[model samples]
Target: MSDSPAGQAAQKNAPHTITLLQHNALKGFLLAAAGLFLFACMDSTTKYLTTHYNVPFVVAMRYIVHFLLMVMILAPRHSAQLVYTQRTGLVVARAVVLTIASLCMGMALHRMPLAETTAINFLAPTLVALLAGSMLGEKIGGWGWAAIVTGFIGVLLIARPGGGLDAVGIMFALGAAAANATYQLLSRLLASTEKAIALLFYTALLGSIIFGIALPWFWENEAPSELEVILLLSMGVSGGLGHYLFTLAYRHAPASMLAPTTYLQLLWAGLLGWIIFDTIPDSMSLIGMAIVAASGLIIAFKSH
Candidate 1:
């Protein structure tokens, strides 16, 4: 039987309940921002290390140490289950493309200014959004197309004649963006069927294996000193910890609440570049970066 009218009135006035897994949007936003900051740290550290070490080896250290850290900590907790995935091929493809993106980004950072390089990469999300219309049959409207054009213009300004940027570095940065877009696309494709831990495991595992195979060619006979070793290890820690923080964040908030703040990494990149390397973007370059960021923001909001 239905409850009395008084009980129904009381029930209607009851407070809305939040699940243990989700509801804290403020905490989630902060965590997402922190995760993006770690990503900026990882990029800056890579650029600094590449000044003294080989690009391939430096990139390898990141993935190798990251893979090791994951094994040491995560494996004990999750055991073999950590490596299980329903979609093997898509997962590997995502990992491979991410590895490629890392390699390309490392090479670019070794040559280009951190802020500009990161700005160029900002185009990747825009590319993914625009391409989804063609690839995934998602109709991106006129605004999406406008964002696409504006994003390229921003890149062109950053790479324009006498921008004082290296042509090869600019190309490498573009390549990284392309590879990164592909990686994101594959990640989206696999999100439904794959477990997060398994996806993370394969990415780190394959990145280490692929880069480790080429390590010999770039190996230095003179071992890095103890301090240098610490820096190398820090790269991996920042990466692993960054992802961990991101995971914690999602448990408290929705993805839509967190997506826009990813652009904060570009700002963090600029500040760190100035402080760490004494590099600053020129006026035109700064404008370009702004345009790129604006374009990405538009795409993000529209999708929401």
Candidate 2:
């Protein structure tokens, strides 16, 4: 029988709605890809700067610029309330842990290939999955466990004895992974009670304060050239803007849909590493990265 006018109107609008949704998803994916590229650039810039500056100085400068950008970008809406939080202690701890993670990752990058260090750091999501049940009271099924195990195997492939990767860099990358996993877990816990801008501001403020205080002791005596200065500032600009783009991406797509796009960072890291430093991961290392990425993708799809 003929449908009512309301039913006909609803049917007419459904395809247009679906098209709009698909468009938004495509935009989100592009934003995520761009953010990953910017992040890769930030890492490459930090690695380059380490040749002339101490790790602490490079890290501090990035966060110092990050802090200034946060003030300009977030303060208008949040005002002094940018520092307010429901769980103050957790927020502070999250900032501290993330700072430590950056320091460790910086140290690793200074001594290792960008692809290798970045691959090892990919263990963070696996660690989060493994620890979530105990730490966050979340449940993980057999698939999650399998993915975690596979991820560790990938780590072993990259970091096995005599793999030609530096032992110190390997240790630093491992530390960064653990620290980052903890940071991710904490961020999840706080997401319910805290504003994203407020959390972002705290991390920027804390990173700057922590690293800036230590900057004096780690200062390089030689002055940087104007070009070096630009690159150094670019670290923060890229990092800050990359993070902004990353957050913006989730608005258009769910985390599950966006999660796999993060693996694009490995590609960006490899390209940047090759272009900037003339290095690429060897055959075994590439296989290891593939394993790590597969494991992470499984978890992302399953968790979604």
Best candidate, TM-score: 1
Identify the runs in model 2 with alpha carbons over 4 angstroms from their true place: 1-34, 137-139, 245-261
lDDT of each: 0.77, 0.79
In candidate 2, what are the lDDT values of residues 1-304, reduced to their tens digit?
Answer: 0034663355355522211122266887798789889989999999999878889999999999999977887688868557766678998998899899999999999999999999998777677777777876656667767877998998899888878999999999999988977876776566545555667778888999999999999988899999898998898889877765764564465443454467788888999999999998988999999998888777666753
Candidate 1 lDDT for residue 205: 91
Q: What is the TM-score of each candidate against the true structure?
A: 0.84, 0.83
- The per-residue C-alpha lDDT of model 2 at residue 152 equals 92
The candidate that wins on lDDT is 2
lDDT of 1 by residue, 1-304 (tens): 0134753344346422221243577887687689889989999999999999989999999999999988998899886556765557878988899899999999999999899999887667667776676775556667767777887898889889898999999989999989977865665455434445677788789999999999999997778989789989998989767765665555554343344456688999999999999999999999988887787666555643
The Cα error of candidate 1 at residue 207, in Å, is 0.9
